[model samples]
Target: MTPRQRRVAIVLGIVAALAAATALVIDALRSNMVFYYSPSQVAAQQAPGGRAFRVGGLVAPGSVRRDGLQVRFVVTDTVQMLPVRYEGLLPDLFREGKGVVAQGRLAADGVFVAQEVLAKHDENYMPPEAADALQRAGKEQP
Candidate 1:
């Protein structure tokens, strides 16, 4: 082959390799990525069953229950509530009637089996997801 032809072939091979690598990366991410939702969003039943995801909302008042490291709470957007279960050391800000986001799966029973729980770090701050859910629910800051 001519030198020019050889160079063109090498470039095409490199391009093909890059395309394959990109596709693989995208596929892997698609499988692993878990989306965030609110209690209302969870109530909509849009999440893929048996796959992990995140849900954020206010910890419903009087919904916090603890059994040592295992905790259960209900997250709410005023109009809807999602039960969440987590077994781990919770953040210091975690409490009843606060903002929380849990990463886990929506079980067949319609509750969330959380693997990790996150709390808002500041008193004046709420998670954006929780804020959005509250806004959608027409909840006013009190």
Candidate 2:
């Protein structure tokens, strides 16, 4: 092939490779994306049924129950509440009436089966998403 044709072929090959790489990156991100929802959103059935997602809110007071390694609690945004079940050690900061974010899938029975639970690290700090959810639910944290 002529020099110009060789250059054109090289450019086309690079463009094709870049497109493939971009597609791969986008696919990976899409698959790994986990959305955040509030208790109201979950109650409205806006969260994905079978896919993993995050729910953030305040742990309802007097709602935590522990049975062996399994723990159950209720997360609420004041407007609505969601039941969450987790089977593992909880964070030291986990407590009732505090901010929490749980990652899991919604069970067929309407319970959130949490794979991981994150509590607010400090008394003065709550996750932004959790705070927003509460505000949207017509409650303000102290």
Candidate 3:
């Protein structure tokens, strides 16, 4: 084969490899990508059952119950509420009426099984989306 033909073959090989890599990355993202939603969104059925997602909202007042290491709390965006279950030590900052973010999948039983529970980092700082949701529900600025 001519030298020019050899160069063309190498370029084509490189393109094919890149295309394969891109397809793999896209497929991985499609399987792993998750979304965040509030209780209102979940209650609206915007969150599909059995789909993984992060729910951000306030730990609903008077909605926390504990059984040994397993804790259950209702997260609320004022307009709606969702129950979350976690089997671990609760964060010191985690309290009823405080903001929280729980990452997990919603079960058909109507409970969120949180793989990770995140407490608000500060008394004043909440996830912006949660804050916006609260504000939209008429509970803003403390």
Candidate 4:
């Protein structure tokens, strides 16, 4: 091929490679993306059935049950409640009637199987999503 044609082909090849790389990056991000939902949303079945996602709300008062390393609790937005089961050490800040965000997938029996649990770090700090959820449920942040 002529010199000009050779340069054009090289440029086209580079463009194709870049496009492929971008596509791959986007796909990876999409697959690993985890969305945050409130207890109300979960009650309405807005969360994905088998995919992992985040649920943020207040831990229901007197709803925590511990069985060895397995702990069960209910998260509520004051409008709806979702049961969560976690099998690990809970954060020191985790307590009843406090804000929490759990990452996990929903089981077939309608329980959230949490892989990770995060509690509020301070007396006045709540996650934005949890605060919004509480407000939407007509409850002020505690």
Q: Candidate 3 on 102-125: residue-level lDDT in tens?
A: 999998789999988888888688
* Local distance difference test, each candidate: 0.87, 0.95, 0.89, 0.96
With a 3 Å backbone cut-off (N, CA, C), the pairs that clash in candidate 3 are none
> Which candidate wins on lDDT?
4
Model 1: lDDT of residue 10: 100
Worst 10 residues of 1 by lDDT: 133-142
**Candidate 1 per-residue C-alpha lDDT over 1-142 given as tens digits, one digit per residue, 9 for 90 to 100:** 9999999999999999999999999999999997888888778887777789999888989988999999889998788999998889999999888888899998888879999899989888888877887887899643
Question: What's the lDDT for candidate 4?
Answer: 0.96
What is the Å distance of residue 51 in model 3 from its true position? Answer: 3.1
Name the better of 2 and 3 by TM-score.
2
lDDT of 3 at 56: 90
- Each candidate's number of clashing pairs is 0, 0, 0, 0
* Between candidates 1 and 4, the lDDT winner: 4
Candidate 4 local lDDT, 1-142, one digit each (tens): 9999999999999999999999999999998999999988998999999889999999999999999999999999999999999999999999999999999999999999999999999999999999999999888888
Name the best candidate (by TM-score): 4
Error of 2 at 15 (Å): 1.3
Alpha-carbon runs more than 4 Å astray in model 3: 1-4
